[model samples]
Target: MAVDLEPLDQALETAHLPALSAALVHLTGETSWLRPEWRPTYTPLSRGETGVPEAEQAKMRAAAKAAITAYLTGKAPMAAIPSPEVLHQMMNFVAGADIPEGYGDFLTDELAIDGHSTKDPNWSTPELKAAARKLNVLVVGAGMSGLLAAIRLTQAGVPFEIVDKNPDVGGTWLENTYPGCRVDSSNHIYSYSFEPNHFWPQHFSTQPVLLDYFRGVAGRYDLKKKVRFETVVEEMAWDEARSVWKVRLKTPSGIEHVEANAVITAVGQLNRPRFPDIKGRESFRGPSFHSAEWRHDVDLTGKRVAVIGTGASAFQFVPEIVGKVASLSVFQRTPPWGFPVPHYHEDVPEGMNWLMEHVPFYDKWYRFWMFWMVTDGLLPMVTADPDWTGPTTAVSQLNLGFREMIAAAIAAQAPDRPDLVAKIIPTYPPGGKRALLDNGVWLDALKRDNVELVTDAISEVTASGIVTADGQARDFDVIIYGTGFHASKFLWPMKIKGRQGADLHETWAGDPRAYLGMTTPGFPNLFMIYGPNTNIVVNGSIVFFSECSVRYILGCLKLLAQTGAAAMEPKREVHDAFNIRVDEGNRLMAWGAPQVTSWYKNEAGRVTQNWPFALVDYWRATLAPDPKDFILTKSAELVE
Candidate 1:
């Protein structure tokens, strides 16, 4: 084989040495490479820095160089796949944690260790294929989850159509086009497990790159041809007689009705932007718009701007626009907790990308390292310890450590500005709300000469300016509302009626509950993608959650096919029991604290938006649908 040894050796210089060490173990069966002194030390911030000393890193790199050369020259043979016990130990060593359980099989499939998808549908027989093909399904919102649903459905030979109000594939990525809009999660694991992109420009890619990734995936899978662009689902009702869902759609031309055997709602939790209802909000005279609906036509150069709500969106965009705006005043409802991440906005180095693109198993092992880090890495820090009678600002001893990390980051960023630091630090415990990825740029933006971080409550917005409770009025040419989304209102504004003429909205009463964040008691033959309580507070990407939820939905469909059942819904008792356990579990989570106010909780104070369990638990529950948990029935035609 023809290979350039010089470039390969050079590339190893920039490689993540621990991930490379793990990959070497998988390749050459060299357990000695994973020495105790070379193991990584766990830290949520600055994840790229494995605590392996400089001497150990150099030794690891030298060993990798020799192994790769031998393998390329046909002198060394790849090892047979390791047993479960060995695999589990290797993962624990690479992750720098002794994860109590074995998720080895899960890691193999999710990370594609063997370089192929093991999660695709297994309905291969002609009979099972026929059963799958006989069904018609409708998918709402052609986003990450919807496109994933389309791919899995197509593999099953099932007939399905996708619809989206926006004329695009990415739901959040397409809509939120504000300056510096990018995914906070690392892009390597934030992507679909089936199709990994080895060449993301940034570790956390910007909106355009992310949108292009989704759009490219949609194109590769031929998903867009099956999707009806500019179409909206207005309402859906279950037809108990036909065992179908009567879905009403409004197309670009006119309104129309369609019927489907099942429906999957992938609209997601963050689509609709929420603007605060400060008095006279509509009275702003300048060009005012929500961050989701960005207006690039209106320039901000030399213009005085008033930004409302310093949430995640503002955290990203404020830094991008602070230099251009003449004067900036930021209104903060509550400060967000952000930890310093050096590569949050940095580009993927060319040599590192070359290593991934060229090295056989290097990218997967690298991704595995990141996935393992976030899988359950931070849960302990944010978990509430009920027996602790300490400060209200922190939930547990571990949580206090995380809080101190953030405090240290703040002090390092702005040592001279004590007054600013006092206003910036959050009073609530860490993980009470969304934790942001900061590189000290957000504080740098806030400390600019023209920028003012206003902590005072807003009194009202007049035709020309905003009035604060402190009796100060600020005038500006533009107002940007970064108040975030209506996250608690899952599946909002859509009219859905289920069995017994059950209204889904009225049934929820603003407190949405589902058996497993997918199916409810009355919603037979319906599945939600990013449904109630499925959002993660301090864990990995939501894409992982979507994959788990879609797998469960498919399991439900396969169950229907095998039993010759027309419909299946979670049993009322089962649904109620599961939710009761969820509430109890959430009561021990930091996000569920009484004083913490966030989008995770509904107006009624129920934790309606977050999953209060381990990442592996969701994976296990959604692996396959249990027959005992649901009520299944045959349709009239099948009953005969």
Candidate 2:
């Protein structure tokens, strides 16, 4: 409510008026405010098609600009909440889904906006802060989720420490330095809901920009002071008797132990890189490294390179390195399905950037646009139709149409290169694997004379080169493992001992499961962010999910503080029931498609990585932790 007029004037001066007007219209829900001529001509344009011509857009922009200037000069406080009808209309416009029963909650809880009470409970309250201060919370990994947890905890006046294995923040962005390593998700929505950056250079921003953004977030919140860099959590034992967690930390100096009341494991699934167990991999004389551990020093100019595994990372880096290498051999175990994205590599236009920074609610509305675009967009395609017969092409009619669109895109991109087309089109369902974004660069790279897409199974990696199953040995100067990470392995390497000294790894037995992907039955006062079955492969941003998880964890802590409880864990029956429902839901998803093999699944063929439900479903589940679903032990009982 206390906005400076100067900032508003700067925004209004060069603001994209059409976009600004639309944002205000969406936010205020005042139809009269936007003239008929200034309104958007197209509601939902198909992919690759431009909507609303430049001439019409210019006119709208001019009108909207004038209107914003008038409103700013009048010095009106922006309405904090819209009418119920306006809210409903906004929901319909943004989500493109039927207004659900708890649509208002979805706006506040999921969106984390000003309309509702999404803020953390008053931990700053003297008694609450005193109780929380007495407790020690250890967060593992100073990544996106961990940083968020720290920020929330700091705001809540909770005492916590962060131990990250990496030297700095930005876990994935810090590690993955592979060429063309950029996010497939839209940059606008990929970030934290509360921390929107309106001036991203690229729509799908590269790793460096992302890393910088994270560092900025960490710096802004003063989170770096609380973090112990170059430290790893080796083991964590929940001392149920003492109602505390004894965490064994591995640091550069020596091993250390920290006793904490609770632990929030923000160590994400994609942190650990998984390399193929190829025979004679060690015998290779050439410099070989996983894409995550990219060797930037090694120059590939005029050198032959072999890129193994055509997954997301490989798909990105291969295109970038193809031109540099004299001959590039891409070994594909399974081809990835590329989603059509015309603006994947395009820069965020200056006009749009101005609109985002200057225009009132424009950034928020833009984020809403992005959120709605991905939410439930591909659910139908990924949801398997048992009655439908065609397995090779797609899962259903809609999915088939999607498949046709992309496949045709590939063909159109490389009409002369049929061999590349055959090798490129994935045999599995579209959403079975993480869908990649393509703007013709990947297909164009494959059509180059120096590039070869090898669909052969790698037999062995000889000192000279790699040998295929067909007994053909191809020589290369360098080998790059574009293979992904150990995603199914949740909280890996850390020997977590729960109640009765139950090893966390042994308990799961390679198939990790968590109740609502946050709490386990035995791990008292322990929470997980971006844990098992919480990975967003298709719909929504992982950052959004992390926010949800952190809030849920905070809610649990709030419950403990309010009840004077020492510790709390999910009830066994409750945890079991939640997982059972998760399993049932996953059975209907594309990841559960019998023939598909992806990182999403564990060794047991169970979907241990993905959230089968929509983002709203998860939002509702994490709104608060029910006391009935948890076994709460009072502080008095613990003392006794």
What's the distance in Å from true for residue 15, model 1?
A: 1.7
Give candidate 2's total backbone clashes.
2
What is the per-residue lDDT of model 2 for residues 1-640, given as tens digits with 9 covering 90 to 100?
4334444444544443433554666444465444544433322213312244667656655556555565556654455556556655555544434556566667655454554446455576788878777778999989999999999898787899999999999889888888999987888889987788989998889999999999999999999999999998899998877889999999999999999999999888888888899999999999999999999899999999999988888878888988888999999888888877777888876656766765567777667656655755557667878787875557777778877777887788877878778888988887888888888888888888998889989999999899999999999899999888888879998999988899988999998988999889778888999988998767468888898888889989888887888888888899889999998888787777888888888888999988888787888888888888888886425311
lDDT of 1 by residue, 333-368 (tens): 899998778779889877788778766777877887
Instruction: Quote model 1's TM-score.
Output: 0.97
Question: For each candidate, what TM-score against the reference?
Answer: 0.97, 0.93
Residue 24's lDDT within candidate 2 is 69
Q: In model 2, where is the ten-residue run with the lowest total lDDT?
A: 41-50
lDDT of 2: 0.79
Angstrom error at residue 627, model 1: 1.1
